[model samples]
Target chain A: MFFRRTRSIPEEYLQNIGAHDDLLRALFVMTQFDGRTVLDGVDLAIRRGEIFVILGPSGCGKTTLLHHMAGMLPPTMGSIQIDGKDIYGIPPAELDELRTHMGFSFQHGALLNSMSVLDNICLPLREATQLPEMLIRDIGRIKLDMVGLIHAQDLEPSDLSGGMRKRAAIARAIAMDPDLVFFDEPSAGLDPITAAEIDNLILKLKTVFGITMVVVTHDIPSAFTIADHMILLLDGQQLAKGSPEEILSSKDPRVVNFIGRTMPLADPAKVDILNYVAGVDSRLPEPRGANS
Target chain B: MSPSATESVAILMPSRFDRETVPALLQEVRRGIHEGQHRICLDLREVESFDSAGMALVVGALRAAREAGLQIEIQGVQDSVYDFFSLVSVERLLEEPQALPRPGFIEGLGGLALPLAEGSQKGAILIGRSMWGWVLSPFRGQKLRLGKIAEEIFQAGNGAMFIVALIGFLLGLILAMQAWVQLKIFGADIFVADMVAVGVTREIGPLMTGVLVAARSGSSIAARLGTMVINEEVDALEQMGIHPNRYLVAPKVLGLAMATPCLTLVFCTMAILGGWLFGVTTVGLDAMAYIEQTHQALRTADILAAVIKGATFGALIAAVACSLGLGVRGGPEGVGRATTRAVVTSIFLIILVDAFFVLFVKLGA
Candidate 1:
């Protein structure tokens, strides 16, 4: 029987993040699905205990980058190091052990609709810990309380509203008290008020618990609000990486348009239906009745 | 090792204190408690790996100590274990379990019955819509794609041809040999042809074909529709003003109904040919005489019965598959459950419908 040989993290990858002593670092990471490149040679570093945001437009590989960082997707090229340990190079068992310290909250609140919210939250603890059922449930309840969703624990995921589902998902993600949590589009489908509340929750979890967070989202205001350090992705490449203030004041037109929402709106008069209808009529032979 | 209430009982934890090993270690603790040990000291110095079950055992021991007015102390706790305990707050584990209100008997009964009632109602609605699409719609100028129905027919019938033929031939050969052995002593060996023809046409051919098709096409339909429901493709169809029953269920139901009888005809022919082979070579009967005897024994009623039973079984299978598939909920597990239930239920209903056909034939005779 042949086995795929596993390699250890190389020495140079450690030196790559040595400058800032970064906790999580991506070096020239590129991801391609089939022949289509989704993430091009993207490089960024996340310092320990900071709320790092990955901001991009729709289909700009924001989630793809997060998945790669979490060791869910192997990059087409380049290396990702979590605390100077190569995520893709190591053996699967080591990767599994490393992943136990991290949590991923999916974009769709991918809670198992078959189970109650409380059970969903307790699932990780039940699987990973030797804690008694009651103790695990207690931990689950605490997690739900942290997300302000204690009362909705008994309800199924399908019963919860979009915002409530996202909160429930967050509760499940933090159930393990992971050192690092990856949140994918936490504010995607919620109303402004609910979205702001989620942002505040994210801030509170960081400030109070001091858990390092990597948030991937296209919502600019939410990103700016929660992000201590941020990176902007455009067309699968890193456009900019800096503090939120630095990104806000960038001179690039694309960055400016993305940050300030200053793109020109369509002129209604030029796009009117009557104009197009008349234009189409003038180009064709006139109707015999109208000509007559 | 000796049990003493005054002296603390020291137990060294295993390297891998997981769910599998926790039970035996727990039994050891229990045995010590029964042997009059008042204080237990669990040593975790050698422990390299621990799972939820290990923590559960610790919590259980703690709870037991407190209730029994004894003492329990954990020594040399690893950093990983300590981190988990600290995060969850060990005090929270010691708290008494909260009592939740249990539902009344009537409420519990209603809880089980409500889903069943809802499912049956949905199943009825699906069957009605499917009938409308299969039988009524074409007469009313609704143009369902003939290509889709043709594809389903090919899948249900032609795809299953080889297996059906093999089973039918084997069954006929076995049945003829058995009948010959039994009839040879009674000087009725020539009646083997009559028995095989009647049995194959009236019972075995349609029954075996139904079971095979149910396992094959029924599971496929259920899994396909269940995945569609999970992926919101079913909802997409509804959004586009297309009835899922008409678009999806009708083709499958109509195709299976049409194809099952045709398959039964082939199965019956193959089976008679097998019996003829057995009677001539093994039993030393004339081949031409065996064919003539089979023709004389098989009535129009038996052939019609086989076709009718095959069509009914096919329709039932499709209906069950489509209903379960369209009604799927939750995730991939839900799709899996639906598929399993579809195959089991289809097979069960096939046997049931077969029994009913046998009764009807007996009564008609």
Candidate 2:
């Protein structure tokens, strides 16, 4: 007969974050994949009672940063502090305890297709609490109402529309009334109207429940509307960090170009068209006049 | 702002005082109380919503104030906050708590036993449902596809025939050759035919066929279904409200159960032929005489026993494979591990079941 043993972390190795005013702090965090650095010595502090958005172009390690902060992936170096405790230094049991106070929503609404929407929302409560089934159901219903999915609670995840699935996933994320909620591309595939509605919901949750939020997205409009603080990442490095307006006004060409979606161009009248047709070397013989 | 004039200090609260900010807010409140302000009013007009942590903060503040010979009053509590306070029974925080009794060994045992019992009950229900589907399929107008059963039968039985035949023939030849040497000293070399016939029909035939099937078909079934699970096809089926066992496992079970006995018969015939060939070439026994002796040695009960063992082993192998497949987790490596586990577990159980059948046959005799 075989039995699994749980490994425990020693107390002396755990870092204390009690002096920090920030709710979550990352100190010189780094992540490497196959000896290639994906997140290079990132230092950030997420203040309490704020919507902190991590904005970047595709493949800029935004999702990797979120995963490290959420404790789903450990940083290669340095530490992440959540609620004054080092996240990576904790034992698995203690880490699970910490995670109960945090919720993470995936980019594609990773709801279990085997369960109904109501069950999906109620799963956390059911697993973590000894609450009666009826009370759990009522809580699930309330979450559904909060997400405007009350009528669709009985439907399977597959039966839901894309927006509905995202809403339902958010509902499930907030089911336990977590202190912090992390969303990955919450509005990636939604229409503008639905995306705005999600943004409104994020703001409402922050104000009404006082839930600190960390959102990773490339949706500039949604980020500006919902974020209290924003960080712009370029190629795995922080390009800028400020309020949305400050980010937009940044003198850094990279920041400005990212936010405004502007691409630098040479003057069309600078004789570039013929040079491009003939190739970069102006000395190269031009193809015989096309008509000739 | 001066507590000396009014004797009551008013502390303005932030718009949000939930878990993240509660510690800082508590520290500030403690600082105010330490400054000799006997009366404090927490102004909450600016605050919109608060959770359990916020409630705890308020309770903590009130306790701190009382300990300092001060009185604290909460003002401008919103309706939403008040609703949560009432729902969670915030008043209980003010009451003194009782010490709880420690759990003993029996209690811990019972705690473990309860979940195990529940899991066993659920497993029983799953088995019952799958068995019902298997038994009722023919009467239900063939809800299970015939092509699928045929495919499984071909895969499990036909695909395994060559190896099973080879092993069966070799086993018979080895058994007869060994028995011939022992019996020839007593001038009873012909008894080798009887020994091979009885042993092959009653035990070796079914056992070899089962081991081969478990290694071949069992691993294939497990790997196939485990891959399906990794791809979320099983989840997709459940999302469509379809019972996976009824659709996936029953056909495999029913097909293997039907095929095993037939394969066992084929295996036995091959084994008897190999024994006859060995007896004629090595022991100088007439082929017809050896055949007659072999036919005389196999009783009807022996053949029935082989068929029973073959069918039982088939069902056991299929059921175990499907269970392991459905329980797969993690990723591609998980599917590989599950396939290995299914084959190992099926063969182990097959041997154990064979022992039980052997005992039953001995008692009947």
Clashing pairs in 2: none
Q: Listing every candidate in turn, what is its Cα RMSD in Å to the true structure after a full C-alpha superposition?
A: 12.0, 15.7
lDDT of 2 by residue, B272-297 (tens): 88888899997889988998898888
**Residue-by-residue lDDT tens digits, candidate 1, A196-263:** 88888888777655789999989876786788899999999888889876775466767865754521
Q: Which candidate is the best by TM-score?
A: 1
Q: Give the TM-score of candidate 2.
A: 0.51
What is the C-alpha DockQ of each candidate?
Answer: 0.09, 0.04
lDDT (10s digit) by residue, model 2, range A103-188: 99889889987778889999998898655454466567666777788778777786788899899999888888888899999999
Q: What lDDT score goes with residue B176 in model 1?
A: 95
Task: List the lowest-lDDT window of 10 residues for candidate 1 chain B.
Answer: B83-92
Strongest candidate by DockQ: 1
